[model samples]
Target: MELLLSNYQPAVFKCNTPKDYMEEALKICETLKIASGYISSDALIDLKRIIELNGRPRLELLIGMHYFDGFTKNQYEAARTLNAFLQINDLGFVYIANTLKFHGKMYSFTMIDATKSAVVGSSNLGSLYDKVSRQYEADILLKGEESSLIHASLEEIITKIGSPFENVPVTKFVEFNQLLENHENVSKVDKDEKAGILRNLTGVKFEIPIKSKPKSNLNPYFGKGRENQRGYIAPRPWYEVELIVSKGITSQPGYPSNQTFEVFTDDNWAFKCETNGDYSKNFRSKDDLKILGKWIKGRMEESGALKMGTPVTDNVIAAYGRNTIGLFATKDPSIWYLDFDASK
Candidate 1:
């Protein structure tokens, strides 16, 4: 059948079943010597098979990080894993994109071989291959006029993924996934009451700088004062470090730098509950702050965010947001850790 749709809920179009569509797409590329499209699923099995085929065509791929159903840890992890896999594999070039702002889903493809064809559907490549689990999904292969529309849509996505935003390299993508996994593991460790209690009262582990103006003096309540101070803000005796909970991972479009976590602290500690710059939101309970501190520290160390320069004293700062975290030096924030895309 030229126009095929899989047998699944919300029936969509496809030349083959959901399970085999990916392989079919790859085979088409192999013959056509060119393939370009977008995918939202993380179906590794299909991906592996496609790679083994050695299509070696001029292929361009864009995988969606955000989903319409909703964003979940499992989904995020799968996307990261798939991105890493694509990065290392000889599958042409791949780019990671997230349209979380609109909660957009990109479970479609525009494969151009000897002729133009498209697969538009609700199913992701990863879910399509499932035998035990069932998620009804479908896709339609289009030619002629319909294929032209798919190509145009893909061109728009490519345009947005350029300039200040660029495709993530394999090395960086893999490192970020590893560190994120480490952070999750460390977060599950038993909480140290003493350390948490102590950290709740103090922001960083190091000694507070005595020379700079104390945060309390500049603004007693910590709101106005913290907001105004940039570059280097002196800590006050009663200052508790405010950890921000970012809305999305850094480097992705619509990832909010200023997001506040709900403060859940003891009577003794309170978060300033304020916004500072584009990267931080104020306050957490003394306890939550401590956990956040430890998580951030673990994430930083494990991710190599704290890599030392020629001088051991040279260290950098690391940040954690929802599903994404990043590393940068405090002295020069311009330099990003594992910055594969230097131009961006």
Candidate 2:
């Protein structure tokens, strides 16, 4: 009747993920209702895709935290987009519980066969893919009679929390997004000025076209580096693989000014990077530079474009199409894209 979901996976202890339960429930359910502390744009997009693949299932997403802690422009935009898609298909709606603050996370699903199921606990809607943002979370998946029992209570909770949240037939998002962004700006002015990020522009695209280089400089595509691989530093391999940035691009706005940043790859991979050396030229993996090497080299190897552990010459890079990469900043600065494409 009840099952425990845990983010942590260890021997002897059964580990159930929120992703597992939700993904399954979404596929067979005729209607889904969720109340979470907050939501992510990526999560909304992903859920929308799943719902599309499954069938036309109505979804009512009630956001709680944004009403209190505030929301980013990206979140607002994502929610709007998903709502539009659902509306077009006559699927469902998204709402915010504004009158009263809410922090609980719960999901209830009504199956096509009339059975009900639910998940309740710390896991938010975005809790599935954000492995690094949150280290641990737990929840309970309820089914059969237990699920049906909770369904009514959960609807009541959503209704009470979302009460007075909006007038019938919402036209636009409340002024919460811009207000939060403005408040954040006011608070970060001094910090941004000092850090030289005052000119940082959100939702900006940055392309750093890296020209071909010899093995000594950009050794990942080539072979071993000009320097020897240190024994102790092989794990985080910070200096093991390096991609030097041009001075011109370094001066551009929206470039990561920090030494460390997270890049979400086009293929749904996350890589932590460090910008070191003079003028922040060294762009290498923050953890295990070898990973950077493996990713790039592996891509080429898979396509039979270049051999692994071989010198990736100018012709090779040019033939491969795109050598340009770097940060693609979003409205939420925390989410950056380091896209990988054969066509740059």
Candidate 3:
């Protein structure tokens, strides 16, 4: 057994990530079985491409988290797309675990030679290659007889509780959609109560640092000048702010993959946002890139925390009290909150 840590602590020690193990398995293993509590659209698409590249080794995915918070609307669509891919190729299948929220990250593989290998860890497929909001994870790799033992266990788990993804209940999906709408439909609340609601029911919330070089005019807030006739940069609307999401929030459910969606900020700014670039790492306003930058910097400017023509470096964000902006997701998928309060 070998322990895998995503952080790669102690440079000299030499470590491999859970992602590395999965990647290797996909490439060489003839059969790969995975059970994960969560998955994201981009991760599934990326996995699909890889499996195709490696000759489509049989792969089965068992999804296990519907009992708690169900999938985002986008995720449901992505899963359908993946199901089609699986069906057309007859390579493998996806199952949703209805008996319980299968929270285990287990991977078992059978190589061409019939030898087996297995991995058990905290990583979901979404976390394996998440560039933004990268998370630290731990997993163990097993081979030889140990791998064979885990393989049988995986089959047993599937037999006991797995249901085809196609067979997953529509009500399971509708429940989450309704939950979000309920949050949005709240009649009224005092300022404090509203704040409490946003914070308390948050699905996941984290701080995102606004990164910029100390001397360059290239702060995401400022303009990256073009040396042509258009030295003048354009202005934007509705407090634009773009952030790289970590641990595959875009992959999770609400945000969806590569599609423009509406989001209302805690400050009451409404805008359409999209995730772009490789692995959907670059997040910004769908219409213009500057919208995201303007939104965040505008808040600082309004609070006298920032001024135009000044670089938004680490010190500036620190002086403003927090080096990162807090993004909170409510049960309402379309509603989100932004926190610019001082860092506690």
Candidate 4:
């Protein structure tokens, strides 16, 4: 039995020349045809490449993390090289590491058997470990029963952690269109044949319809680069305003607890005032309204609502209603219209 431990500090284990120990073990493996195993959280590039070069058909198990430098120019290419090696190799080995944390920081170790000898170390399957100082960083080496225990532990961890990447169903266009249709104001718009396709690809949960109108007092206060228009309400189509009151509705600073706004846009994209700031009566300043408009615009962009020619008129009214009243007061507002071209 031969023992090879890289990354082991003499200060901790009262021994120097950890590299010497690994070299001795590698020599023993070259002489004896025995199996080997390793366990570590970090690996070196040179160690990985060396194992691939030497232990092609004899290496039993190789379990460890794969680390890389994302800032390097050949990062992806180096990764691909490693992947190709894994794909073709038929050694009875396992590679265990989180794929998600690939570009940041990673660690892994491997075990190899040569002839009648076994070697274990905390070095990865790479080429960068040729430097003496980089190879002797941690205390990772065991043999005989101890080595067997480490190998078993590595197998257990691989089984428990499993692969991170798994297939998941993506939302389709019809589903997205149906969700938007569920919203009070949005469904009435003609489903541009393209709209359904667009919504399905991106995952967005459309709000249920709320039958509310825009306040005649609240107007567009913010613009791209224009002067602030104070107390100027844009002309919008008329719609009935209604508030649904339930028992347990509360107010929060940034989020609506139990309040919602419903706006019915006519074919002409006119805004109807609803909620009338009557639920909890928390007055919002002109500046707050402007900020709310910007927030809604951002949300629209994220949800791909702007591309559908969705106007900000209804959103402005909804924000006013939500800010003025608590979030829980109005559950859902239904906006219905007969014509779509009028609004655009």
Best candidate, lDDT-wise?
Answer: 3
Error of 2 at 287 (Å): 11
lDDT for position 215 in model 4: 36
lDDT of 2 by residue, 228-299 (tens): 232111111111346778778776766766467656555445556677777777777664554455456545
Tell me the spans in candidate 1 whose CA falls farther than 4 Å from its real position. Answer: 1-4, 8-16, 31-49, 66-90, 98-113, 161-344
RMSD per candidate (Å) reads: 20.5, 15.2, 16.8, 23.6
For residues 285-316, write the lDDT of model 3, one tens digit per residue: 66544445545665555455664435566666
- Per-residue lDDT, model 1, residue 193, is 38
The TM-score between candidate 3 and the true structure equals 0.51
Per-candidate local distance difference test: 0.35, 0.60, 0.62, 0.30
lDDT of 1: 0.35
Backbone clashes in model 2: 1
Local accuracy of candidate 4 as per-residue lDDT tens digits, 201-295? 32212222322232322222111112123321221211111233322331333223233333322222212222224444332212123222222
Off by over 4 Å in 3: 8-12, 171-344
TM-score computed on alpha carbons, candidate 2? 0.51
Residue 26, candidate 3: alpha-carbon lDDT: 56
Comparing 1 and 4 on lDDT, the stronger one: 1
lDDT of 1 by residue, 239-296 (tens): 1234344334333443223433222122122221222445433322223233333233
